[model samples]
Target chain A: MSTTTLQRPATPSAVHLTFGRVVASEWRKLFSLRSTWWTLGLAVLLQVGMAAILGAAARAVAASGQGTLPVDGVQAASAGLQFSQLAIVALAVLTITAEYSSGQIRVTLAAVPRRTPVLLAKALVLTGVVLVTAVVSSALSVGALALVAGEHISFALPGAESARILAGAPLYLVGIAVLSLGVGALMRHTAGAIAALMGFLLVIENVFAAIPWKPLQIISPWLPGTAGSRLMSTDADIAAAQAVPHHVGAVLGAWQGYGVLVAWAVLALVAAVLVLRSRDA
Target chain B: MIEAHGLSKVYGTTRAVDDISFTVRPGIVTGFLGPNGAGKSTTMRMIMGLDRPTSGTVTVNGKPYVEHRAPLTQVGALLEAKAVHPGRTARQHLRVVGATHGLGARRVDEVLEMTGLGPVADKRVKGFSLGMGQRLGIAVALLGDPSTLILDEPVNGLDPEGVIWVRDLVRYLAGQGRTVFLSSHLMAEMAQTADHVIVIGRGRILADAPMATLLAGPGQEASRARAPRATELAAVLRSQGLTVTQTGADTLEIVAGTPAVAEAALAAGIAVHELAPVRASLEDAYLALTADEVEYHSGVGAPANPEVAR
Candidate 1:
């Protein structure tokens, strides 16, 4: 009798796709989809185009000597960040929401049974992609604004103020991404999540701020969008003038502002984890 | 080997999969049989750890599926008709999953070739036919070359050739000492491919036995009869320990173990007209097992029912 041996190729262990490998895989998934690219492209276009146009307008106003160059060049350059934040939020929500829409989340969960790891991997990938884009976009917007405005925009590069705002913009976008991801996980529906996120950022917080109450104003700075917008502004004078009594030092200091953003992010992430763990895929 | 111990799943107030338990072994294709709402898909999902069981547990290779270090390498499954993202190309989709386990692009291409999907490897899944999508699903299942496979309704939309191909592929896999568990509502398909069957209905196990044993089981009625005048064969066979029913004026149906008894009766005094064994088909076995448990019964009488004909 003759015995035959079968040859099998080596199979990698599942843990080989550690949290890091899962993050990389998620990054590939996020970027390969047409929706991700389209949204990211729109974010860049809106950021850079709005910055250039605003820079031109700001130069005209400054040249006429009617208005002071509002803040620093980096702050003005990143003017698009305000509007572009919506695009990043949409991208982040869609990162997980698309799976629910297409019924692919089940497959994803099956591949990685530890639910928290899958959610964390998605957040990590989203943060990485959005942060890099936000940083590059902010820098280009500032540089373009300086060149087109044709004014020696005395923006401190690598200086404390410049570094703070520069670092804060990406951090702001990251916070928005996490906030939107939490909303997405809670809602589990793309339209519902996006609508709820937009409403909370654009309407509800502002309405609460409008109430004739000091406590509302004090707490308003900690809301996701409000905290993010506060972190993006570079004019210390304007920031100070608008700051509430107790909010003066806490809201004006760079690290303090970053801390507010992180607080909102952590709260949203915790909520997202709870919803994801409790809900059915 | 894979085992399910009192597995149950509930969605709201409805129990999708009741407490069902069965074992799937190696070196054979075990057909997971059920009717259309019989919880076959839900059970398969629970086994794969896609859906958490409400009560019991399912283990693969003597461990919970989630506890396995390499789940895909331990058990590969194609849970649905098509689970790929529509935007991704076949190769890209496979590569994304492959990368998770540190498997390179080469393995993706290899599985693509094995599934005969290399020709359309670069095409977006949105444009692929149902058959192509099924093939893609199978490709992913084979990506890890696992020791066990669980494919749910894998032959749903295949052509005859594709059907034959899948049957061969599953049988071949089982022949190689791998355990193959497949679910299908089509009894003919199971009959052609499976060596053993685990029949389910109303989220409960109906039967779990070897194919041959199921065929020869006692609950099913088999017929044989013979007489000089075929019309009188029914009466004579009924005189013996057989229940002879009439098919036509000249033909009779006798529920018995063998035709030799009918032959003996004919040789004694009566002339033999015909003596043949009436074997129960796979469909008969399945319907007999699940007849009482079928949800939404049509309320229509069987065509063979004498009262219904009248």
Candidate 2:
């Protein structure tokens, strides 16, 4: 065609921009990418796969010992956090870093010029999606563990400690994801942000937690990665760590560890929003 | 309407956009004309609130772009083509941006059809060609049914047909009593589509006036003349305080009327073979305007860029 003209709608719509609408837009943006689905799916697979193997090992140990090996089914289900957390790292980091890499940040900033609303909306969407996905994946991993361990593990409704432990998996995963998103926003590069986050969550946290030094031991549980994972620890899991020779990590309640992770997320988000507000798109 | 007052942006020591002010009124197309590094895109980005100006204020409609109740409705800017995630389909990207203003899927589909991207609405942007990417960008800009459109290099990657389509589309939008501001380095394109023009060079306003005034340019009539000794004739014309540029081996274009050139050649010893008045084109005016800017911004700009295309 040589040329064409657009016909505006006869009646113009009265658009009212609200924070909820921004959140909705961010939700659409997150779901439209295939990477979001693949990474989340991998998290579920890793958690369930680890649950199965760990459950089988518990059953084998019980058979060899001539005694019942006490297995917390929920703990076995979430045993793969170390591996699955990496998937959430990739997903959350990509959520913001991909926008920067592809130059879509300009379009987004132009649409919502207030700036803070955009990052807040992204954080809200990331938290909501990760919370739901983590909850469902935890349930699936529990089922896998119960199936592999048979009667050796109980899937019955839990006591307070077990309930907290069961809820901890999703809570910890969501915390890590939101934290990663903040880091992504601050770094503004896909590979750099992902590597920075992965290094802290995987190597740095573990290294500080296992060094068997007094100050490192005291500060270890306060690190987001170490403390956040502790959110899924049952009472027996805490006691088991206490039993380890020259234990180099702090012993904190599940909720308290989750609180520490939330603090880290909040601090990162504040920094990200500040940087976003001050920096040009 | 868009109004910028004393707007300026500085990157390190370079003044990307100097303290400049201009107004783009509704019901007419305003062509933002500039050279390759003329800060046209930077100024557009500043208007869109994508880049914060170092000093100055710009407002769209009646308020700053960020202050609008619905920014997208007030102004739709195509800051860059392919400012989209490759993994998402065109429809998905449109829907995502549209959702920010509470726009629904119906409007998204309407824009897809309007931009002639309906067939590839569901296709991932990664596989789209440059022209397709540009069309998708226009669809996004049109999604909100915005009253003001700011397009930076809208025809950058379009085919001939697509280029004509955008030229017509912007003209149509301006005719609808909306404010349409588009930037381009193509002088001929601006001459065809714009009713008003603002020419920029080296981050400063070189000229701003109606299209007719710009083409008339400096109130000088350009005349063409051929002489046996053209160089001697040029020296004599320069002595008479007339601007002259050598166009060919034996021809000179004098910035004086045909009578003035004939009188000067008659007074001199050069025998004039042919003499006539020539119409000044937008390209000539534009080149002349930028040629001055290039000289003023020496070292950074070439002395003469005769090969700068329209």
Candidate 2 C-alpha lDDT tens digits along B125-154: 999998999999899889878999999888
TM-score for chain B of each model, two decimals: 0.88, 0.83
- What are the per-residue Cα lDDT tens digits for candidate 1 across A150-185? 663557645876777777778888888987887787
Worst 10 residues of 2 chain B by lDDT: B294-303
Pairs that clash in candidate 1? B223-B254, B228-B271
- Candidate 2 wrong stretches, greater than 4 Å: A1-13, A62-71, A154-158, A237-250, B219-221, B225-256, B260-275, B292-308
Interface RMSD list for the candidates: 2.3, 1.1
Instruction: Evaluate every candidate with DockQ and list the scores.
Output: 0.38, 0.67
User: What interface Cα RMSD is found for model 1?
Assistant: 2.3
The C-alpha TM-scores of every prediction are 0.87, 0.88
What overall lDDT, based on C-alpha atoms, would model 1 receive against the true structure?
0.77
Off by over 4 Å in 1: A1-16, A62-71, A152-158, A211-218, A235-239, A242-254, A277-279, B224-274, B302-310
- Cα lDDT tens digits, model 1, B1-310, are 8999999999898788889888999999999987877899989888877778999999999998876655668777887756777898988888777666676688888999988899999988889888888888888888878899999989878888889999999999999999999998778889889999998888889899998888777564565554547655555566666676777656666667555455646555666656677788777777778878777576466522111111
